[model samples]
Target: MKLRKLITVAMACIMVFSLAACGSENTQEDAAATETTTEENKAEEVEETAEALSGTVVITGSTSVEKILTDMIDEFTALNPDVTIEYTGNGSSAGIKDTKAGINNIGASSREVKDEEKEDTLAEEVFAYDGIAAIVNPANEVQDITMQQLSDIYTGKITNWSEIGGADAEIFIVSREESSGTRSAFEELTGVAEAGGLTSSAAVSEGNGPVQAAVAGNENAIGYVSFSFIDDTVKALKVDGVEPTAELAKAGEYKLSRPFLFVYYEDKATDAGLAFLEFALSEEGQICVEDHDAITVD
Candidate 1:
């Protein structure tokens, strides 16, 4: 009978230990679930905070940067649907002036801002680098031209195609308009920024597209345009034995290159403007720069 009682007590102790083990397991499981819930809640809060940021951003600047910036803006707006962005492709100098006058939220320039053009209130952020391609008609037999030869041809010093190993036809110089950012960059890089640098007789187009079309349609025409615009329509010449490309530009091997800048007035920047700038300088925006065939700052 004592043995029977002892056996019953042992069974009771076993039940108590089993219950304690089960309870401990349940407590650990509950703690794990709580941690997972806390992490999920934090994630949801971050998503909500990102979605809450919404506003309008206005950008005005160089037509040279218009295409890339437009693509970036489209991507950025897809995430921040309520954030509005408007871009105007005025000349770079005009954009800078407008930004200074509070007419624009941000100013885009294909070239670095000149010291004389910058104000104490303004800040320059270079987002990308662009290579200026010297283009010619696809039919042109000229495969390469030195930088000095290009400068001479544009300046009317070398007016004949035969002077650069092509046919004996007269070289038609197609140039961008005076206010074009491409023109400013081209002139500066080619050492033609001095007075009467570009030939007054050259056919002047207003935008990069027009310049490309003009060169593409004329067999004897030579022009310079943004590297992104060069395709089968025109042949890009090797300057000083190096082809103008984004990689060469980034490596400083391409001479006809310039920075793509975002100029803003720090004091005048709004919350939307600041957010947009952050997005532009982000990795995603840099990817857009590469997608557009320009070199990212990084």
Candidate 2:
């Protein structure tokens, strides 16, 4: 009876060990399956990113550039169908301020960094070359003028179309407001001292389109805007015997030419910001520049 009892005890112990081994195998299989599922989930997330784009891109500054971006956005949207672009016609200074404060994703500037504004960790990328033009109403007989004359008119030294050339009418010195990037660029070219001061007898408008419209609407009006803004309604005058043109501007023959740049946070190298900026500089994007009546770098 003792031997039989021992035999039963041994058999029971063997059964327990066999059950534990089976349980271990099942646990290992479950862990492997779980790992495979986790990997699949990670792959699905990547595929989703590849399949669709969804984000709002805010670009602000240089109404002149904004003109081009509006059309670019139309084309970009057609291709992307998922990304949305929003642009504002704020001046370069205002745009840069917004960029620094994290209010805007991209800031369009017509010139390089200023002394104080350079303190931020933002990055700048030049996408196009821009030349500014002296715009006059199409009805005005004066087709061309010199930098000296333009400076004189802007400084309130010359106040009539007759003072320069055209009809004997009061020349409304229409211009962008003091906060304008275009104005800053003009000031840099003509020498601020020659321009008198920010407070001149000129009529300052809120934005570039207004400046363009004001000149186009009034027969005796004169203003300065980007060469791109010179359309059928207004005439672009020469500066120092040089026309504000792409070719002339590139050779430095055009004195008022400047670079159109895109400003962003310094991390632009590794963000969606890089993609848009790359597109802006791409061959296809450069082609779109003319759609808005502007010149492209390439």
In angstroms, give how far residue 255 of model 1 lies from its true place: 1.5
Model 2 TM-score on a 0 to 1 scale = 0.77
lDDT of 1: 0.88
Per-prediction TM-score, please? 0.87, 0.77
Worst 10 residues of 2 by lDDT: 266-275
The candidate maximizing TM-score is 1
Q: Put down candidate 2 lDDT per residue, 222-252, tens digits, no spaces.
A: 8888877778988888777776787787777
Candidate lDDT (C-alpha), each: 0.88, 0.78
Residue runs of model 2 more than 4 Å from their true location after superposition: 1-49, 193-195, 268-270
CA-only RMSD, every prediction: 3.1, 11.3
lDDT tens per residue, model 1, 33-84: 9999999999999788677777888898788887789888998889888889
